[model samples]
Target: MGQKVRWGIIGLGNIARNFVKDLALVNEAQIYAVASRDMGKAQAFSKEYQVPNAFGSYKELFDCKEVDVVYIATPHTLHSELTIMAMDNGKHVLCEKPMGVNRVEVQKMIAAAQRNKVFLMEALWSRFNPAIKKVKETVDSGEIGSLAYLHADFAFYALDRDFEGRVLNPKLAGGSLLDIGIYPIFLSYLLLGNPDQILSTSNFHANGAEIQTSIIFKYPKAQAILYSGFTSRSEMKAEISGEKGTIYIPGRWHEAQGFTIDRNNENEEIKLPTTGRGYYYEINEVHACLSQGKLESDLWSHQNSLDLITIMDTVRKQNGIVFPFEE
Candidate 1:
């Protein structure tokens, strides 16, 4: 293979660990460095991943000349800052989903990448998943003919976790909307494009963080109903219904391994398993972009990130959800 894309992880959280595990599966990728606000945690993560360097501060990892890309797995509030920092330092970036708390931050991030002439992408990994890709292909093929409706839900019971933690902390931009709602919203946008009209409502925790959110995207020819929450566990299934048929993605649809299509009352399931937590697909996309000297992924382009964030901003506004951190 060509030169491995040296990866530097800026957060040592569980998501970061899972991402590194999948990174290991990519031949064109290597874990070069990791950082955490806590030096001990950084050291521990580095040792566990067999990385070459560890730092207590994110800047140290960002400055590593050997690091080609830095994956920002920090909280939603930190995504914009770290992405801009990494790109400003001449490193490419793959920031975790939501990309930013709102549209303004995402715009700044995209501009920074352009000004610095470095690669950048929002790590909406589900878009690259094998099953999701197949779903897209099936939809585009008109097998589900004349799409009429789409329904998706992503939720989990998180009330047991720390109320002041990221899941329910407004300071961190925590809420069902940014945390898990983006998946269903993304699926809608991916399949139907921007909605002509959007309707949204949210139920908030006592701490001002949203506990549950319901959104409806009205397209010229279709409608997508989406729900997300931390108040309870949902089946997490997604269904795409058309005039002639319907496709069902089983529970935990975001990481779905298979999907069933029902046409004229006949159901068929197609299995497409992913290797390792499904993060490897996006990692491979980053590898391909860097290898081709591209600054952004064509599959999940900057425009797509902008559009997604814009949709999110609208939903938050409609539901009266605003983070304290936004200026």
Candidate 2:
């Protein structure tokens, strides 16, 4: 552990670029290396980010002694393998969301991190957002009374994209649920914890990929309605209702810039903007955990990742959405 945390990025995709931009915002972090299957792409990304090292393969980046933690920004299907590999090579990991395609894979990734005695976290950036933090604080402070219900949705149009692309490809575990739906589901889980019963249904594309998913999480005293789809656009709003009043997170709630809290028939809007693309908060969490010599984040623990994936697994099973590559 040096004065600055050395970061190695395993993928140079759009998300990876955004993450690097936020990395620059963290004074204790630096992009030490980057890797891509294509040497040219790796070299170009390295040069663009002013990273000192670039590797043609992920293994090289994992083996780089200068690198401390590796950010796994590859596709959903590759997360488990790459994360375990990085941990095995004596490097910590901050894997991109969904952690893995299923609970089984998430279990393996967590085991690897524990065995290697290195920190590991799922990059669920929304959990680290200031708006989300405030929402939690308000709820816990009894400002909203007892929670009664919640509704959230995330939807977009992706039919125009290539069918073989990551959003539509079955091999990549592509689907609205795992790709974008997780946000709504996560919000429900964050506020209500795991549900007593989960009822779900999905609409599939011609290629057997799921395009839309609707879930109803039933709790003892509350319920959550969640929806995610790729066939059309949605308001992307989230609402939390309680006995006293309600909290409204406007469109794009997952990465929301602000939220409205209504109590006693009076609505007040609270704005909490991000420094970058809202990824800096999670990066800061990683730095804090590693600096404390902890192998898992208290906010987004390994068990938390496993629980989320298990919920998705149940939803997928109920909806009969199975990826082609799954055994």
Candidate 3:
């Protein structure tokens, strides 16, 4: 067996809870420590996960010599700050996506990695998803013919939640766009590359948090229709259509279980099961890269993270969906 990669995680939120469960499934990963602003919360998480150490603040985890990498699961606004801190401490990073609140922050994070000569990656787990990977391969192989159109959406009913919560809180950079919109945007960008033009519309709450956003990315040979909102539940299915046939990824396509291809008016289904909430794949990628003494995964390189943020930045600029931190 290869040497285990010691991981320290910060932010003990719902997403972090799911991530820890999946981390347990990766044989080469070790829960060296976890940190949170609240010492009590940090201790509780460490006890629950059976981690070796717990720290009251993020810097403690970064300074810990036993921890080789840190997973930043904090709010979008805090991503850049925490990731750079980790890298500056000579620890690698797997910061959760959007990677930053905007493109500038992402660039800073990437620069930190290069300056420190440490690994860094946005935790965009979907990029390593088996079903999505196969679909990308199929499209690249010309099996789907020349792509003409793509449709993908991600939405959930969250209007009833507390206004002060993350979903509606401008201070936290909370909104549907960065929260769920990245999925559809990722699918479109993966299949069609950057669009020639992008048009977008957004609705905002009284507090200036963007509640909903619909975007259209126009390519020379193709177009993508994407939507993300907190107004109501949307069909999370994703469709990529071409001249010869169409490929359909069923609901919750970001963590899709499988996909289908329709050719000659016949539908053929394919299943690609993932291990443990689909985070194991990315965790494995990180381990593989670390073992190979690499700074980033080729599958989801630094450029990919920057491009994804750049696209969202354009969409935000078009619709006036500015986060407070960016100001």
Candidate 4:
């Protein structure tokens, strides 16, 4: 831990803001540079975060010798392009989730990492969440018998957001399925692996942007019912139930601070507060992989990303949820 890993952040969006805040909590990491399309935004962000370097162009940041890794926080459509560029420049990458809009884009991103021999990972922070990890471990230990059912939903009334913003805009690969639906989908995949079959449908805005999605991942013995939307708000609770009992991730379960277990009329709640907004867990995961000279994370491997996107691709195809870019 003699030399801290220097991180360069692109896309000065809200997610990147929250991620930089969490990076401050980890001593092994540093925000060395920040870049935005607008020079004013880049300078302002670098000043606010006390970062040493600010680039108006992303490639200048990529070309920076001081940056050891780059965090791609751009729109979903830009993930593959920017990630491949950054990796080709000899920098590790931690791209935000929904790694790509579909499997083809994701496969190319994976190939970029392999070709460059650089560390790469999708920033699926929840996979490293202590409470969620503990719950998964508990479920695996047969504490809840066998997982037979799981219900998870993520939604926030985003209908009022900008019609052309990422959340509601079809051009940015926007929609609940790739934006928030991936949470519930990931929860199921984490606990149940891939599903035998996926049944799904969507409700779209007048402009053709998908606003709501209801999905059922069918397995041989277990089934996961998941949903995501911008039309209304959901409790965002997740219930992982088994033959013996259930585990409850209450209220905004994706970044859950704790979870509960109910079995035989008994209840137990375990709380594991995050350092910041919980992005640091995945940041540290990146650091760990870089330290070990590994190309991918074991917890959230390249295969895991492929499987996740492949599943979403199926749902999109099944329901005709095509982004403007894909067409």
Candidate 5:
């Protein structure tokens, strides 16, 4: 626990770039190091981001004594390994989503964090988005009444790329479900607790990765219709219907925007502008937890991560999609 929390970026991907850009907005955070499999890439990213140090390998970043935390932006299959490595080296971890390929991997990561007595969280950055926060607040205020159903989807076209790319390759744990699907799934989990049952279907590429997926999550009195895909584009809008009224979150609903609440007597729009890409909020949460000597974020707790991935696991299982790492 120091005056400033020093963080290291583990992969030089697009998400990492967004995260670093957001870190600039956090006064309590400092990007001290970056690591990538390629030394050239690592050095380039460090230079671009003005990070203090660059490492040719993730292990080097983990070993750096000055790095208080590691932001894991590696692929889904690598999340468990890199997270455990950082935790073993006594560094807190902010791992990217679909925290693991399965429940077993997530459990191992959590075990390492507990054993090391360090902080760990799945970087489901959407939960910290300004728009989503306002939606949750409105629902909790009893204005939304009893939740009836929720619908969300995230989709984008990546089919024309190399079949070996991460989104289509089985070796890298590629699939729409893990890549973009986790967002809508996470939304459902946030608005409604884990459902009582899940019915999922997906169209698989010849290589066996899920290309598109649709899920129906059934609860006692509520339901969620969710979709994700790599073969097409979606509106990316999210809707939550409650007994009293409805809340509409605009497309890219997970990010900086607002929501409109339709009540019995009136309709109102709420706007929330975010700093940077909104990853800054999660970084702020991490800094606060570390400053307070806490091990995980209350907003995105370990159990919540487990629940999200568990739901994903079930969806994948239902669709007959399994990664090589799982076997």
Candidate 6:
């Protein structure tokens, strides 16, 4: 709808800062405005990123006609409410992962996007990574030959931090399952669609938030083991094993640097270098999709987002992790 994709950033946090830096790599992308609850912070982010406008309230950013898209970098709990507000005001949205706290909120966000005729997508940036792209290609090519089992994990130690920190606060929808856990879950779903059955367990912190979680997904022909935690760091390697061979993505595989293939008694390494810390690809995707007037990305479609959240909801239900917002 505009010559350049003008971006308005909501919630100027650490991730927001990283995204702004990544925006520099996209020729057709620009950060036109920023919003935060604190006027000072908003102004600081605006000046730091050379954004032309800053708002103390999200409402102001949404109402600004110059903002063609709003990238939501708020905590997990606030995504549903804030995304709906942005879409209702005719702004396209690229929300951070765990698109909503639950499936219901995701449903509402999708409905709002459709009703307002604005594009909306979850910022599952890992899906757009080049290493992951190549891995998916290998899987689809049947190089793996009927995926049988997969193991993936994401974890980090942050239990000693203040209870109110976004990683451990229940009010903010804080938990290993929602934050780091989504990576493993996405890997499983991407390699194998929605599982036929899900079995999960979690270790809760003193504050009742999940500190660790392990999930098992059973498919008709395959099974996946996925885990995430906040009390310790995991290697964060992802592997897909099938009848023919096993594919291994190096550590921190969610934002992988490269991958190795083991097939037919032979092994080979494939390397992919990321520019702008790997956030540039997703930004470019948003620019392309919005310019084409698409409501959602086919790669990360609305139904796909729904499917991931629904699996998360089921895992939460099984683990007895309830968010206060759930009715």
lDDT for each residue of candidate 2 in 11-79, tens digit (9 for 90 to 100) = 789999999999999999988999999999999998998999999999889889889999999999999
Q: Candidate 5's C-alpha lDDT?
A: 0.90
Which residues of candidate 5, in runs, are more than 4 Å off?
none
**Tens-digit per-residue lDDT, 181-232, candidate 6:** 9999999999899999999999998888899999999999999999999889
Alpha-carbon TM-score of each model against the true structure = 0.98, 0.99, 0.98, 0.99, 0.97, 0.98
Error in Å for residue 301 of model 6: 0.2
Count of steric clashes across candidates, in order? 0, 0, 0, 0, 0, 0
List of clashing residue pairs for candidate 4 = none
Better of 1 and 5 by lDDT: 1
Off by over 4 Å in 6: none
Model 2, CA-based lDDT? 0.94
lDDT of each: 0.92, 0.94, 0.92, 0.93, 0.90, 0.92
Q: Write the per-residue lDDT of candidate 3 for residues 1-111, one digit (tens) a residue.
A: 237888999989999999999999998898889999999999999999898899999999999998998999998888999999889899999999999889999999999
lDDT of 4: 0.93
Predicted candidate 4 versus true structure: per-residue lDDT over 1-327, tens digit per residue = 249999999999899999999999999998999998899999999998899999999999999998999999999999999999999999999999988889999999999999999998999999999888998999999999999999999999998889888888899999899999999999999999999999999999999999999999999999999999999999999999999999999999999899999999799888898879999899989998988989999999999999999999999999899877677
Candidate with more favorable, higher TM-score: 5 or 6: 6
For candidate 6, give the lDDT: 0.92
> Candidate 3 — which pairs collide?
none
- The parts of candidate 2 lying over 4 Å away from their true place are none
